[model samples]
Target: MIVAEHLTKRFGQKQAVSDVSFTVAPGKVTGFLGPNGAGKSTTMRMIVGLDRPTSGSVSIDGRSYSSLRSPLTEVGVLLDAKAVHTGRSAVNHLRSMAATHGIRRSRVDEVIEITGLTSVARKRAGGFSLGMGQRLGIAAALLGDPHTLILDEPVNGLDPEGVMWVRRFVRHAASEGRAVLLSSHLMSEMALTADHLIILGRGRVLADAPLADIVEQWTTKSVRVRSPRAREIAEAAASDTVSVTSRGNGYLDINGATAAEIGELAAARSLPLHELTPTTGTLEDAYLKLTGDQVEYKTKEVR
Candidate 1:
């Protein structure tokens, strides 16, 4: 388990992270999400003792990372896959990392096979592709068989098959009671892999809740309606409490009303409805709504 209490970070005059607090417990995958420069990377660095927090504290399993007697066996980290030595082979790199902790050579080979690097185990690190580099980083992280895993964009350069493998592997690790903290820009993947979410915006904790609760609290569920008289239905559904938008081509998106409500309104108005489908709130929708005001950079409308 990882606990962060009132964590804050500063770079000269600017504050990168401000009084953020969250817990990543064992047996569940917790996703850390944020927009560009929202301090997600900075916070992760502090957790692993790479960067110092200006205030407050972070601990893994009730002990600070620096205080851990065997840091590798206690927490696994993959902050930067490209930070490896270019001269060493994949197998040699893992072996060197293992040697520092007195890990057996068998364990080094185990991670290489586990990460599917057996084919290129002897290849120089600089010669590997982005996907291969990510695999090597994961291999090194697993070399220690740590109880807690912290990964940042583990699927960044992976193929679809590699992505699915990571999803399953993280879930399986959590099932074995390991604490898993993951960060990713891919909302769809997070929706599938994460049991809980910790959202950051402008260096502050915007939300910390279960995936379902965050979606329910921040997003408005919508209903999709298809009909020949789409404009008429939309006009009728528009109200102070309801919102309706035309999608063109005989489709309307309705919010603040359920499928049953839409169907009843269509029936009462004698408007034949071909489809009335309710869409559950998605993680992307909730994230955008909550961080809409917090985004530091905004794109101008083309028009």
Candidate 2:
């Protein structure tokens, strides 16, 4: 398990992270989500002792990362996939990291095969594609067989297959009772990969809850209804309990009501209902609603 208590970080006059706290437990993939410049990288850096926190503390299994007897064997971090020296081969890079803790060379080879980098393990990292770099980074992280994995944008440059590989890997790791903290800005990806979500905006916690709970709390549940007498149904259900929006061609999207409710209303009115289906808001909708004002950049459309 990983615990971050009142974590904060500052760069000169600007505060990168502010009093952030969250727990990444074992047996589940906890998604660390935020917008651009929302301090996720800084927070992850502090967790691994790469950047000293201005205040508060972060611990892996009750001990600070720096204080761990075998840091690499306890917590494997892949904060930057491109931080390696380009001159070195992927095998050499893992070998060097393994040397720090006396991790066996066999473990390095094992990780190479596991990450599917054995085909190009001897090639210079500089010539590798972005996907290959990501694989190398993952291999390095798994070299020690650590119980906790901290991955930041692990699928950034990966193809569809690579993305699926990462999703399955994270799920498998968490199922084995390993603490997995995955940081990413992609809500769609997080929706598929994370069981729980930690949303951050403006360097503070916006929401930390199960994915279902977050969706339920911040999103509206609604239903789509289609009827030949759409106008008649809208007029009949124009009450505060229901909101109706026309969807063109005798269709409407109704909120604050369910499919059953709409069906009953149509039946009572003898309305010719063609379709009625339930619809729930997605994680992207919830995230946009939560961070609408906190977004750093907004694009303006040309008329």
Candidate 3:
């Protein structure tokens, strides 16, 4: 397990991260989500001891990363796919990393085969595509067979197949009782990949809960109705139980009203309905709603 307790970091006058505390447990895929410049990278760097925190502390199991006797064997991290030496072959890179803790070459070969990079193990890393580079980084992370994995944007440049492979790999690692902390900006991907979510905004945590719970907290179920008699329907359903809004497309968006309730009302009024679609907001919508105000930048249309 990885635990971050009141972790805070500051660079000069700007605070990059602030009082962020969370636990990433074994046997579950925990997603760390945030918008650009939301302190995600900074927090990860601090956790791995790449950056010194101004205050607070982060620990792997029960010890700080700096205190680990065999750091590589205790935690595996793929912070940047481009951190590898461009001129080095994939095998050479993994070999070098494994050699750090007296790990054998056989383990390096095993990771190469596991990551499906054996075919191009001899190729220069600089010449490889983004997807291949990501795969190589993952291979290096698995080289130590660590009990904890920290991956940042693992699927950033992956093809659909590669993306699926990463999703399965993370899930498999967690299932084997490894602590997995995955950071990504892709809400749809997180919705599918993560069992729990840690949402960050402006260097602070906005929500940390089960993925389903966070979604439920931020989104509401609604119904979309399109009819020639939209005005009449709106008038009849404008009670406190339902809130109606114009869809700006000759339709009405109704919240807090179920399909059955709307259908029954329409039937009683003898209103001619063209469409009645039940709509539930997705994780993306929920995320947007939660972090809309905390975003660092916004683009406004010019007049």
Candidate 4:
């Protein structure tokens, strides 16, 4: 398991992370989410000892990453896919990494096959596409079969098949009692893959909770209704606990009321209903709401 206690980092006058504390337990995938400059990468770098924290501590299985006698055997990291040697072949690159930790060539071949890079094993890394580069990076990370994995944007530039593979692979690793810390921009995929989430904004943790809890707390379920008498139906549905909003044309967005309730009300009023659909809150909805005020940069609309 990975544990961070009041983890803070600073770069000269700027604070990159502040008093961040969380546990990435074994047997689960913990997603690290944030805006563009929300300090997600900085924290991950600190966790792996690439950047020292200005204060506080981070440990893997009761030992700091820098103090691990065999770091590769204890933790696997894929912070940057392009950090490899551009002039080396994929096979040679893996070989060099394996040599650092006394890992065998057979294990390298195993990861190459597992990551679907066997065909491109002899190709120079500089010639590989973005997807191939990501695969190679994953292969390197898995070379030692570490008990803990830290991946940043593991599915970037991947095809649908590759993305699904990563989802399944990470879950399988967690099932085997590995600690998994993942970061990604794809909210849909994160919803499907992560069991827990650590949300950061402007160098501080905004939320650290289960996926379901975050979605339920940050967004509300709503019912969508379309009718010629939408205004009328909305008037009838509106109450102390429910809110109805016009969504243009003959559509109404009703919150705090179920589809059944709205349908029954419309039926009792003899109102003609074209459509009545219930929609649940999604991860994207919750993420946008949680980070709405924490965005570091705003893009103005082109009028």
| Count of backbone collisions within predicted model 1 | 0
Model 1, runs deviating above 4 Å: 297-303
TM-score of 2: 0.96
Candidate 4: tens digits of C-alpha lDDT, residues 116-181: 998999999999999999999999889889999999999999999999999999999999999999
Model 1 alpha-carbon miss at residue 235, Å: 5.0
lDDT of 2 by residue, 1-303 (tens): 999999989899988889999999999999998888888889999998899999999989999988999988999899989999999999999999999999999999999998889899999999999999999999988988999999999998999998999999999999999999998877888999999999888899999999999999999998888888999988887788888999999999988887888899899988888899899999999999998888776678799
What does candidate 3's lDDT look like per residue over 44-97, in tens digits? Answer: 999899999999999999888899988888899999999999999999988998
TM value for model 4: 0.94
lDDT of 1 at 95: 91
* Superior by lDDT: candidate 3 or candidate 4: 4
lDDT of 4 at 264: 91
Q: Which ten residues in a row have the lowest lDDT in candidate 1?
A: 290-299
lDDT on C-alpha atoms for all candidate structures: 0.95, 0.91, 0.92, 0.95
Q: Which ten residues in a row have the lowest lDDT in candidate 4?
A: 256-265
Off by over 4 Å in 4: 227-229, 248-250, 272-274
Top lDDT model: 4
Report the error of model 2 at residue 177, Å.
0.4
TM-score of each: 0.94, 0.96, 0.91, 0.94
